[model samples]
Target: MYLFLSDFHFGLGTPEAQARRRQDFFACLDHYADRLEALCINGDLFDFWFEWKRVILKDHFSILCKLKGIADRGAAIHYLAGNHDFALSRFLQDEIGAQIHRDEHVFETGGRRFYLQHGDGLAPADWGYRLLKRLFRSRFNQKLYSLLHPDFALEFAHLCSRTSRNHSSRRWDVDGWAYREAARAKIHQGFDYVIYSHTHEPLLEPLGRGVYVNTGDWLKHNSYAVWEDGVMTLKYWGMPWMERSQEEGYSKRQVGTG
Candidate 1:
């Protein structure tokens, strides 16, 4: 069984809220840890994450330990970089045995081919964001930013993340056409499922012969997805199961079993 989640944006909320959400997230992990074949974090686990040589973000320490414990229990950990948390490096890999993917991850599991991405730059009209992504991801720029004190850098990054998030919310299209189109293109290329999570809206739409899933975010929906026995289903944090439909239209029915 594979569990997929995204867009926690851990540092975006108040300290008390963040702690409560973190504990709930930890409980979900603990519940599923022993049965999971892999735990895939699709993106934006942090609001902003940048690690200096000797300074790492301590806010993520407890969750990181929980993830490491899951890894130690025999589930592979796959952390895909999201727009907000794109500064990820080797710390997760070294400490939690995580496989960090910068943009997308392609894998075969349960006899199915899955394509996973954070759904950031897939839209052609998002040229400005694409350019900014390049600038922020430049190795030289990262090196220069790393020269600043970690405390100041993190504070600035968090402020920027908040502003950017506000701006994005104002302009975000709830229909999510770009993500659906992207999934359509990938499904034509032979993937059984295309998963994404930047829009923060949960979706499970059938496109051609394959399916498209957006794992949604922990902020409002607390949604996730699971792939098991050759089928994938989107679920809420407290739901045990959501039955999948094969028809063009998808409908979710909650069940009582894992």
Candidate 2:
């Protein structure tokens, strides 16, 4: 079985809340470790992630270890860079055997073709943000930012992230229709499944002969997707074994190849 999740946005809430969320995430990972064929983290696993040479966030060590364990046991780990945590370097790839992607990735698994992305700059209305994204991702900016001390750099990044999140919370009122439309367009382009994470809304919609899935966010809903035995499911982990079938098109089947 392949598992997909996104928008953990770690370090967003109060200290106690952050700890609880981290524990919940670790539990989810542990539950699927043995059975997972691959684990795809769509995006925003962290509120801010920047890796300086020879510097690492001590708080992330435990989660990193768990990921390493899962990879060591033979599960492929794929991480797509999100707007919040896009500065991934070689640490994850070298230590935990993760495949890091900056944008969209396509691959075949379980006899199905999949299109995966972090789903940030998809809407034409987000042109301003897209232009800023380009500037932020440029080599000149990255080099200049890297020259700062880790403490200053991380603090500045965190402040910027907080401001961005505040600005974005108001716009989620759109119900993610724009993202859904983008996904539908991809379905017409011949992808059997188009999976994205960023809007933090768990959704599964049948489009033509394909499917469009949003794995949702870990901040509130704790939602995710699973693909197994040619079946795709959207599930919530707010409570153990909780299945969300309220949507018009959803199922509650247990996911596995067995």
Candidate 3:
């Protein structure tokens, strides 16, 4: 089975909040550690990802360590870059052993074809936002921006992550429209599912010829989506101690067991 999650948005809130949420996230991932064929993190694993040569996230170690353990057990990991965490360098690929996707990709599994993307620039309702995405992604600009001190740049980027110039009256409407269009185009090509994350919305609906899945974000509602065998589900992480502690959230985890 394949596991799908996205828009984690790490590093935005307080350190304590981040830690609590990360634990819940890891717990969910660990639950299916032994049965997964591959773990797919669709996008925005971190709120703002700018990889400097000497920089590191002190807080992500636990989460990374958990992923490392899973990889050691043999399930491959795939990461799709999100708008909030672009300009990824070599760490995730070389060190973490993840097959990283800078954009969308297609992979076949379980007798079905699946299409995946981070759902950032694919939504056209936010054309202005897409333009900024292009400017920020320019190689020249990335190089120029890389020259700033890590402290200053990281702080600035975190600030940028805190604020977004969203123009949509209803964000989900735009996301739904964009994903539907993508699904129609891909279904003609023989895909059974189209999965994406970035709008921070968890959606699973019947499309023209397949299913469109969004794994949602961990920032607020704590949601994700998963598919096992033929069962597709979106879960909120709720644990035994959920009401009092940080385990009060949802998760999207799947093990093929196929």
Candidate 4:
């Protein structure tokens, strides 16, 4: 089985909320560690991640350790960069054994071809953001930003992220038809599944003979997707069925039980 999740946006809320969410996320990593053949964190695991030489956020230490443990256990870890964490550097790759992908990735598993990405700046309607994305991602801009003290830079980035989140939260229900159309195009190009996360809206829909899935956000829905036995499913970790098993939870016995 393979597990996929995204839009964690850790470090967004209050300190207490952040800690609780981190524990919940760690539980997820623990729950699937034994059964996973591969794990894909499609993006935004951090609300704003910027790495400087000899500098690491203390808050990410635990999660990084957990990820390293999972990778050591032999599950392939694929970390796709999202808009929020586009500056993701070598720490995850060098220390946690992750395969980093900056934009999109394609691979074959479970007898199917999969296209995976963080789904940012994909909609044609989001052309303004797309333009800004290019600017923000430029090496020159990144270098200029890196000149600021990490303390000030990180705090400012987080504040900007919070403001962006507040604006986006109000439009959560807006349909992402553009993304669907883009997925359909990929389906036509021979992908058996096009999986992405950014809209933070969970969806599993058939497109032609293929499928399009959005794993949603850990912040709001705690949703994720799984591929097992040639089938794919979108499930919420906080659902009744999962809640019932919270005590004796997530054993190998539960592998295909979901």
Best candidate, lDDT-wise?
1
Query: What are the lDDT figures for the candidates, one per model?
Result: 0.82, 0.80, 0.73, 0.79
For model 2, residues 1-258, the per-residue Cα lDDT tens digits are 899999988867887888888888888888888789999999898888877788877767777888898899999999999988788889889989999998988999767789999888775566666776777788788889889998788889888787556544336424677777888888888888999887776778787878888887877778898887787878877553555432346432333311
Question: Which residue pairs in model 1 clash with each other?
Answer: none
Over 140-205, each residue of candidate 3 has an lDDT whose tens digit, in order, gives 998888899877888888666654424322474444677678767887788888887766766666
lDDT of 1 by residue, 30-147 (tens): 8787789999999999989898988898878888888888999999999999889899988999988999999899998667899999987666666667777888789999999999
- What is the lDDT for 169 in model 4? 29
- The reply for model 3, stretches above 4 Å from the true place, is 163-175, 239-258
What is the TM-score of candidate 3? 0.85
TM-score of 4: 0.88
Candidate 2 lDDT for residue 182: 82
Angstrom error at residue 144, model 3: 1.5
Question: Any runs in candidate 4 off by more than 4 Å, and if so which?
Answer: 163-173, 240-258
Q: Is candidate 1 or candidate 2 better by TM-score?
A: 1
Q: What is the lDDT of candidate 1?
A: 0.82
